[model samples]
Target: MAPETPAEPEPMPAPAVILVQPQLAENVGTTARAMHNCGLGDLRLVEPREDWLGDKAVAAASGADAVLRAARAYPTTAAAVADLHRVLATTARRRDMVKPLTTPRQAAQTLGGVIAAGHRAGVLFGPERAGLGNDDVALADAIIEVPLNPAYRSLNLAQAVLLVGYEWFQAHGGPFDMAPPASDSPPATQADLDNLHHHLFRELEDCGFLRSEEKRPGMKRNIRNIFQRAGLSVQEVRTLHGIVKELRHGRR
Candidate 1:
């Protein structure tokens, strides 16, 4: 008899990550890793500075090279997002671009509607150093920002990509009939978040997100990424439930 076939995953809509004027190889690699973690396969690079397929990127990606392998490069952000019907731009800083700001949750809700309508969507990330410029922001239908600490605001490009991708993934419910691994997956574990926190802070240390004075600058944003990627393991999510209860009580 033929070998037993493995179970197939559910079908889900695809989201294209459009990196406009991405400046570094390492960031591109990290972003690819982020996309892979969230089940997003489409990578569109608009004028990337380094080789996305170079060893620096693949190594940085860890095991997300498949995302890198399927990457597409373009000359402009508009061109990169041309085929997409819904577009979102990710930014931590204010853009004078005149776009409405939507939290990841709201964006996720909206994305679900967009997908239901059978239209493809794209999410935009700006350059590492300066971030998305006015023209770049103007290209998107909405502005997506993670709620970060007011005093200190900064996020890694890949982390930002992961957050939005996670929201979309959660809403999309993974592949069609199979539903990938989301929806049914339990909420995150405190232990998992703690572990994620450790890994994230280390990544932050590597990127200098946590400066000397403030150890956890914009930590909530980073935490959001961890929470987003972890997919809330069912048994592990009691921690989140307890934390919410404590917060509500504290407010009293």
Candidate 2:
């Protein structure tokens, strides 16, 4: 009998990262560097500022020339994400549209699942100064928001790409030094967390806990990030509300 053939290894899953109207060749190169660092190879450019393969970009890439060389360019955002089944737009600021919003971790998991199910996915990064326009964002099925200090939340193009890429790596069962303990309570949905944020913010605002209207946004965002990191459950959220109420009443 013939020897059994060796089984083929499972193909690696990666999402396409599309840079929409990128402003700097250096940023594009750095983005390529970041993508390669996280084992993501698909790079697409939508109307980049300079020749992506030029000297400056190559210099910035720091030996990720293969990624730069294999990159594809498109004329518009629509064309960029045309063939993708799942599309996510990365932005620091919240848009007014009603769309499924996800954290980087959540988005990565969703993207990984989609790819595993035999679908193509892509992430869109807007220009440096101005992020995705409503039109560009409208094309995305979901918005990926990185919890950050609201006062200074702007992330450089490559930095934003790196973060999402890192999450994607982790989502795909990438080896890591540590893993978070599973939550006892059901995972809190984004809407549930948002409601808690609103409830807490209203109370804080009423009691002047977050003073300095100018700093209020940043302060609230920082507080929210703290809770988000904790991965609070429904029960925990209610308990915190009770504690806040009791403390406020006692002070009064």
Candidate 3:
């Protein structure tokens, strides 16, 4: 009998690189090139100011036209991450939230584990100038802060994405040999969490729980951070929805 060739290993599950409100097409192109270099192809843009797949972007992407051509644009950060099971936001400065913090390498390891378990993950990069806002950061399950020089920590959009992407590429297959952690239920998607947020917020508003316009934003963010850190499962989210609905019905 002829010897049979071994089946090839499956390609690593690459996380989506999401750019929020990116300002320049060239930056988007360069970002695409960087992603391509790391074997990543999912490029998502939220409210980009420039045409990401335009001539300038294409020229800047060089031969990475595949990433640019397949890029998806979203209207909001929430919409961009709605389908993701795990999300990490890249930030330059410390925030007031209590989410888990990790370096690019650490985040890459975590993302690799998540993907190995058959869940989708993504990293969010904010605008070129301001980076991620508190609102954008709150949506993430964790924060990725590159431990750069404290004296002058300044990186452009593509540079930041490239740093993380490189780490992710390096760490991709490291987790595949190990067994994924067991779970009773699948993790909640960002869309499920968004629905829970909106549902809970509506009930809170109806019950006059968020009457203070000055504090409402902060309060909402705190609530989001709490749930985000909980790592709620799909069943847990549904139970919470039921709890919220029951509470609202009791009042009526």
Candidate 4:
């Protein structure tokens, strides 16, 4: 009789959790717990107001101190993400700038795809007082926002992370993709995206949709917003690029 082979486990992408200017150690610990619950272990702190490795954070982390022990700290958001090719920013507020806005589920889905391609991705949470600034969001490859009752949409730092992390876990059908299913890869690179943006602007100019390049800064933000929200694939971006190029060439 032939010996039976062991089944291969499905892969779960390990993601980094970035707390940008987190306000309290308690929240930091709680956030670590949330990440642990979702099978995520990496934590990065940026200019934290509270000592995450202190007693308060450890106490708040409850059974998740292990995750906290592994956490890393940075002086700036840029440094926190210096190594990641893909960045996802989480926020509760909407900006006037054009950028892609995705739900927690969508971000999770995108994360899955991005991870399949072997690129690093991190989820960014802004300060409790102001959330992520426009400049912060501008740096991210994607934006994730949770839906709550508009009347009272406020979510504590840990809760916001939990929601997103939970979706990410669900997307893989568990805390880890320790099964045989394969995932899709994320779209293009930042360079590829930048080129697409430039060509799209040129197409807009040809169509008279974009006027006075100085005023286009906001438009760039906005346009970036829409596509990021769409979470277009590499193939999709290529198609869009072709369309824009043809349009700019005055093709019928």
Candidate 5:
């Protein structure tokens, strides 16, 4: 019998790069160019102010038209992430939200696990004037907060995307094509976590745990951080939901 040839492994999937309300078409084009350089292809836009397919964008993309050509546009952040299983939003300034914070490298590693499981994942970038709104950040399972010089942490839209994409590319397989580390169980999806968060918050509200209007936001964020930092698994999240329900209504 003839020897069988070894089968090639499937290529690792890349996370989508989503620009939320991008202000400039040129920036969008450069962001596309950056994605191309990092071996990333998926590009999504939420309420882009300019025509990203126009000439300025193409010129800014340099030679990465394919990425721009295949890019998708969404009416809102919620709609953009409707099908994504995991989401990470980037922010330069410290937010009042209590989400798990990670660096570019760490976010890349997390995405590796998401990709390994064949789940859709994406990174959200906000507009130039201001970063992602609290509502947008609320939709994310975690936050990507790059550690930069304390004096100046500002990064243009393309630069931010490129930095994150570069880290992701390197982690996934850059020049070496290194395999990602295996995960025991899939982490809780954003939807699952969001449900947990809402359920817990509602119970807390009913119990008067979050009574102070002035302090409620900070307190809620702190509570969220406690769980977000835990990197809960799906089962863990379910257990928590049950615990919350049990606490609220006594034993069934």
Candidate 6:
């Protein structure tokens, strides 16, 4: 048999990482190094306290010059993510303001979905001394809080960026191995899952499983979560549909 052709490399999902009022050049360099490590190329500085491209940063970048060279500077957080469709703000402290909060994993998953849908996404990291101010947080669509010791929750600029960047890489960087998996079964698509949910819900409603008006919302949510967590395959979804139909017919 002839040799198999090499597969093309998966395109890196570029999410712009904005550093707001960064205090240290070394931290900026280290952050760039972390960003490059996780396949993130777009770096933005908003009113940096130190020279973003100074020797301290370059030295700390440890050979991540490409990221440093291509970095951009902005006057404000709003200006940095103006073109992006979704922006997430990183903060350690609990805010009293009402806003959607997500973990790093969730944010990365959301970013993957946003990028897949051809929309721009970005993340904002505040200065070393103080995290994103209320005004900066207000500009973001969602807030990302890394779980830490409640008594002393503090993360340096590079550490926070590294954690987020690492998650994004894991979510969208594709399989590390070049070889395909042994299983040929395709994962069920969202539409397939939705159709299955609808079919199951209809059957449940017909059987008076959703008769409780007050509990219907919670019941539906629980059922959806159960199936979504399964990460069912296409054949598995079909099997589930068959089971639901059989049960309904037997009840009739």
Better of 1 and 5 by lDDT: 5
Provide the lowest-lDDT 10-residue window in model 2. 173-182
lDDT per residue as tens, model 3, 1-252: 989999898787799999999999999999999999888999999999999879999999999989999999999999999999999999999999999999999999899889989999999999999999999999999999999999988999889988999998778734544654677888999999999999999999999999999999999999999998998999999999999999889666
- Give the poorly placed runs of model 2, Cα more than 4 Å off: 1-8, 176-252
In Å, residue 47's CA in model 6 sits off its true spot by 0.7
The models' CA-based lDDT, in order, is 0.80, 0.90, 0.93, 0.86, 0.92, 0.91
For residues 1-252, what per-residue lDDT tens digits would candidate 5 score against the true structure? 989999988678899999999999999999999999998999999999999999999999999989999999999999999999999999998888789999999999999999888899999999997999999999999999888999999999999999999899888864574555556667898888889999999999999989999999999899988998898888899999999999899965
Cα lDDT of model 1 by residue, 1-252, tens digit: 999999786576767888888888889999988888778899999999889999899999999999999999999888898888999888888876667899887888877778778899888888987889888888889999888787877887898888888877777755547545555556656676676555545655666656765646566566667677766675556565555445444566
CA RMSD of each candidate after superposition: 18.4, 16.6, 23.4, 20.5, 21.9, 14.5
Question: For this target, which candidate reaches the highest TM-score against the unseen true structure?
Answer: 2
lDDT for model 4 = 0.86
What is the clash count for each candidate, in the order shown? Answer: 14, 0, 0, 10, 0, 0
Local accuracy of candidate 2 as per-residue lDDT tens digits, 1-252 = 999999988656799999999999999999999999888899999999899999999999999978999999999999989999999999888899999999999998899889988999999999999999999999999999998887888899999999999888877746676756666777678888888888888888898888898999999999999999997787888888788778777665
Clashes of 1: 14
Q: lDDT tens digits, residues 87-143, model 6?
A: 999999878889999998999999988988999999999999878999999999899
Considering every candidate listed, which one attains the maximal lDDT?
3
Question: Clashes in candidate 5: how many?
Answer: 0
- Better model by lDDT, 3 or 6? 3
TM-score of each: 0.65, 0.67, 0.66, 0.65, 0.67, 0.66
Error of 3 at 251 (Å): 99
Model 6 is weakest, by summed lDDT over 10 consecutive residues, at 174-183
